[model samples]
Structures are given as C-alpha cells and as structure tokens.
Target: AIAEAIFRHLAPRATPLAGRHALVTAGPTHEPIDPVRYLANRSSGRQGYEIAGALAALGARVTLVSGPVDLPAPPGVALRRVETASQMLAACRDALPADIAVCAAAVADWRVAQEATRKIKKAQGAPPPVLALVPNPDILAELSTPGPDRPALVVGFAAETDSVAQHAAAKRARKGCDWIVANDVRPETGIMGGMENEVILITADGAEQWPRMDKRAVATHLAGRIAAFFTAQRSIA
Candidate 1:
C-alpha cells in the first residue's frame, strides 16, 4: 500500500538521531520526612516521557534519569530510576558525555534537613510540626556551568506561571543552557499533564513561540530543531 511505503520512508528518516547519545531527566522527586510525610511537586512526567520516546525513535541512545513516575521505559532506551535530586545527579554523572542532555525533571528546590524514621504522633493542642528546608543543587545550572565533559547541547525547561517568555529568556541566561523551553502553567492553560502546550523556544539567537499544539507536535518540532542543530554542527565539523 502507499501508506505502507510512506511509513517505511519515515521510519528510516528517523535514523538521523541514530548513533547519538541523549540524556533526559524526568518527574518530581519525593523527599521523605517521616515514614508517611514527604515533600514533592506537581510534575506529571508527561513531557519528559514523550521527549524520551521521541529521542529513542530518532535512533539515539537515551539515558533517562527518572524520578518517581509511572511511565514505562521507551523502547531501546536505558532508564535509571532515582528518588532524590542528589541521586538523579549521580545517575547523570555516571551516564557521562552524552550528545544532548534534556533537563525536564521538576527537581525539588529544597528538602527537609532530617527525616523522621518513625511517623510523629499527633498530640492534642500541639503546634504544627516544623520542617527545616535546605536548597537542592540546581541541576541545569550545574550542568551548563562550563564544566568538564558537559554535553554538546543542554536543554532546560522553564515552567513559569507569569511573564513566561521573558522569564525563560532570563533563565537561559542565568543557567547558561543552550536552550530553554518556556511554558506558562497558569491553570487555564491546561499545560500540566495535558496533551497540549503553547511553548516558546529560547536560545542565544532569540525566542520563538510556537502556536498551541499537541505534545506530539511540539515533540516533533523540537526533535526536528535538534536534528537541524546537529546537522549544522556536523557540516561545520
């Protein structure tokens, strides 16, 4: 069938990403305080999972450092499961020298200093429990900070609820990442866990906003851009 021929052609074209190594971080880490109490965020891991799948389809060797998430591993991709930002960082360091590193994980900004081995019992007329919080490493900043063995390209996400584009630009400058995908997570946008997104791609060149589209479309566009960048680099090389 003509459709079958089209599919075959498309499949081979996907091989552009082949022979390349990609590293992606996903999901929100849970920091346990007591046996029951924990600190976490609202990251659904949807975008990161989709990105991993896209990268795998492109024939890249993908190393996905995932936080707590329910998504299955992409075919032909190696996954490292981690529960904390520190663990995730360690995993990434172990992966090493990837062609591209995508920081999609919503890493916790802080963690409780000490975790209670046992759950604290509630007492009548007692004040609320106090938790001492400490800042976690800014993984993206660390990776993009002109380090040794850093990836050729580092992509970070800036999920801002206000001044999305501007903030993303600033974040890219501050973090020194090659690219930042900016999204407005205001409740009405329905971006979180939703299949759709309105995103702006921020880079040293400029900020380019894409019309609202499904996640698959966004992934395809991003993948294409990544491929183009690699191709340009190859030509230069």
Candidate 2:
C-alpha cells in the first residue's frame, strides 16, 4: 500500500480519479454441474485485471470482483474472488456506491437448474443426461439501473461472434450503461485468450474503433478516457 501511494504521488499526470471508487468485474464464472465438474468459459481476466491496475494508477480506489481465474490481484486493488454468477453478483453489490463500474466478466448466461450433488455416471447403453438450464442474473443491467447506488459511469463488454458493433450498440441500450466495449471474439481472432485486443467503444455519441493493441494498452487508454469523463463532469458541475 505504501509503495502504491508513493507511485501515485510521483506519477506525471495529476490524479484525476483521486477520491473516486471504481468497481470492476473480471474473469469467467464457473457454474457447478457436479462435485467434480462445472461449466465455464475461456476468459483469462487479463483485460479486466489490467483495467484495475490502470485505474489504481490514476489514483482511483479499485475493487475487483473476480470469478475463478489464475491471475493474481492487481497492485493496490481490493480483490474479491467468487465461483458462480450468483456469488459474483453478491460481491459486486458489496463493493457498490462506487463512482465507476466496468463489467468485463464473461459471466455464464445459464446454469443447471438443479446441480447434481454427485456426478452422473454414464451408463453403457443409456442416453446421456439432459441438463435443465436457467438464466443467470444480469449483473450489468443491475448496476446500470437508475438508483442512488448506480455508478456515474457504467461500462459493459460485448463479446460477439457476428455483427459486433450493431449487437454491442443494442446491448448498450438494453443494459442502459454509459458505454459498451465491443469486440469480436471469434476463435480465429485469438482474442479470448490472447494478449492483444481490438475493440469498438460504443457510446451514446457513436462508436469509435480502436486499433489492435496489447491488452495493457487498451486498459490505459480506457482509464484515460474515464479520467476525462470525470474531469468533464466536474467542469459541468
């Protein structure tokens, strides 16, 4: 903590995000199907972790609510780890009353309606088990809802396989978030588990396509934009 403070103090740019709290959600939720197995995704939590670090560098008090991932917590950021979507939502609620929120986790859309306590054995001649699925909570929409606890700026991510910009724009409207970072995560793009990313930043104004760059670079750029957002708000106030 002391080292982080000193680094922030010596940083070249003024800490525009100082005195603000930022909440970030990262990684992929694991929906348990049985004691030995679970459903999950390919998210490595790199982008979100980088964003947390970048926000802390800008002097924001960051709380990273993460799902199961192998990455370590970012320096000077509080980390809350969870396994399932429900747990992730709870952690996010606990970190609320924040000034900024970035929902970068690729949460599972569904979970087994009834998770088996024991793994089902595959019978030699029987049909495979049919798993019933249920919708998981929409964390982004919940955070974006109009309320006192809602962050001033809420950013959501859209990992689309097709019609990236159009789908992301629709998601922004549907979720009522301030912005959406949309990216094509087609397997061929190597983005889901890769170090680099190319995203389209969708805002109420319009969509801005960013060049492919390292994930850390994307985080830094986004943090700069966030700082500018608060600066502009302060001026208007």
Per lDDT, the best of the predicted structures is 2
TM-scores, all candidates, are: 0.92, 0.96
Model 1 off-target regions past 4 Å?
1-13
TM-score of 2: 0.96
Position 27, candidate 1: lDDT: 91
Q: lDDT value for candidate 2?
A: 0.95
User: For candidate 1, lDDT tens digit of each residue in 8-63?
Assistant: 47787656777789999999988888899889977888788778878877767899
The lDDT of each candidate is 0.87, 0.95
